[model samples]
Target chain A: MAHLASFSFTSSPSNSASSLSPLLQSHQQPHLSSPLQDTLINIDNSATMTNSYKYSVLLPTYNERENLPVIVWLLTKTFQENNINYEIIVIDDNSPDGTLVVAEQLQKIYGEDRILLRPRAGKLGLGTAYVHGIQHATGDFIFIMDADMSHHPKFMPEMIRLQQAKNLDVVTGTRYAGNGGVYGWDLRRKVISRGANFLASVLLRPGVSDLTGSFRLYRKEVLSRLIESCISKGYVFQMEMMVRARQFNFTIGEVPITFVDRVFGDSKMGAMEIVSYAQGLWKLFVAV
Target chain B: MTRATEAATAIGILGTIYLALLFQWLPITLPPTIQEFILPVLPWWVLVTFGAYSLGNIGYHVMTFRDCPEAYDELQVQISQAQNDLRSKGIGL
Candidate 1:
């Protein structure tokens, strides 16, 4: 159970809770000014932008002390190797495992500008954690994935490459497509996941294959738009995001990804989350 | 799925029954045994159900046609970053 000083991002607030929180952040974290200005654009074939893009990786962690360091290291290594301009925004919900302390230590090693730690008071909803994290992001694109190692940072470069190649609004990873498959789940768990996804496909017909998949990269504005339109606050949020994105006529593409189960602690998903997902599916069928 | 269709289905089924009774579409000219056996029961239930289903489908389309779609609310944004900051430092609201 470790935590640290609450500092805002370059454009972050001194105290975010103030009812008068600014609508737009006008400042950049002073530390980031130089690097951001001289950012080198990777994937030269990308013709969408005049300048290099800044990536904000939003990592939401709870009791992931053991796996956090490795994930962050991998992410930084991946971005650095590819010469990609990136920032890691960790939104940690006070874990009893001192995950925050490990995050701060990584920040010191990697430098504060590259590793930003934004810690919350308690265990907020997963949806809200992402909400909290995205606000502090100052990047052209946003990446959301698990810190528990279920998702590998190695896939990020390829995801970005594909996104730039297609200029897609969203590029989600699918375990049910291409060469992707679940790595460590038993038969019953596999059946449940497959069944849930199958039901979603039949009901929502969201064009895309993996509706429940969480690993994804989104253009900043598109991600913000979908998040605002989305109503789900739990596991269903992922599915609704894909469904609503289609409803809004946004282009979505998929990349096959091997979804390995978490390597540490425990999985946050459970019976309650599954039940909520079924209810959410029904609501989506009726509404969308 | 709208209220209009629910009401229309009920109305259509009842309406068909009333129209059937008034028009007496069931042929009374048939054999006495046939008339007595099939007259009041079989055609009534099946046609009423079919009538309800058909009108309900039409009503669903009509309601959809007349309904205006609500615009997505664009103003809703993420919460301020201070939610994480203030609490982590132990100065929570």
Candidate 2:
């Protein structure tokens, strides 16, 4: 909202309402009738296009060589079609499957400015990966999501618009809210997810619909601070980030997203993770 | 002032009042019939109600959870498109 004008694609109509997808239009506010409304209003206010906000996507990869290229392509296509300024930071923890090799190939295709490869020596932690990615991030806003293709990049434009409209610190994609849903999850998986979400909601009451969702857009500074303060790892890390975000009184928004469970890789939700999730929830409950 | 302490404080205060009322330690005593029947079973009722609510909530969510077969289908299409595009870009997938 701070004079960061949305991109104006000349090829598309000035009042291109069709740019808003059905999923995005469902949550559309009056001012958001078209994605170009902001540009039209703020065109005269800003002289230079260089100052428009940039979004940096942090995609952490581990044994995702197959999915990496496709996800990056999706992200690139989404941003290009939307005309949104962005960069994708691939934080590969020395993937044994040569995810870094694919990332380098993507860098060559997308150019070094758009795709960044910040590889680590070994498998570290999720929280630290974001921290590392953030250090190299050149964008005003940061997006953290899976490289495993569960979270589609199509929702990112809406997420960005929501953030801009509301001037929110965090905009998380929720599969539990609105028309958001998960694909490929069976009854047992659904039950466990719903049950775990219910328990977390009852106990922590974080005021966010999806506490464990990794698909989120954060103001760069806000993300840096949240990462600095958060102390958990794995699924709980995502949960704690939201809980802590609320504790800091940061404004948050939600965009319904379709999570098509890992199309190429195995999705993990074992008993060990569940137990550790409970322990992490308890820790945040008492400590936060 | 964390969530845990806040919950504990509320429960402790409510529990103290419930105990006092149940034990007839309060200045005003409850009717014997009401005290003997309702008070003792009140906690059980709350527990059962809470458990039922939780189950219902979880069940409702599970049932209503949307299945996006279209998204899966779209992704399948996009994956092929990406591979083709990447291939055209001279990067082997």
C-alpha displacement of B85 in model 2, angstroms? 0.7
User: Which portions of model 1 miss their true places by more than 4 Å?
Assistant: A1-51, B1-93
Residue B49 CA error for candidate 1 (Å)?
24
lDDT of 1 by residue, A24-99 (tens): 1212233443332222121122322333899999999888776777677678767876678999999999999888
Where does the lowest 10-residue lDDT sum fall in candidate 1 chain A?
A: A17-26
Tens-digit lDDT track for model 2 on B1-93? 888999999999999999999998978867888799999999999999999999999999999999999999999999999999988987767
| Residue A136 displacement in candidate 1 (angstroms) | 1.1
TM, every model: 0.64, 0.88
Taking all chains together, the TM-score of candidate 2 against the true structure is 0.88
Candidate 1 lDDT: 0.68
DockQ of all candidates, in order? 0.03, 0.82
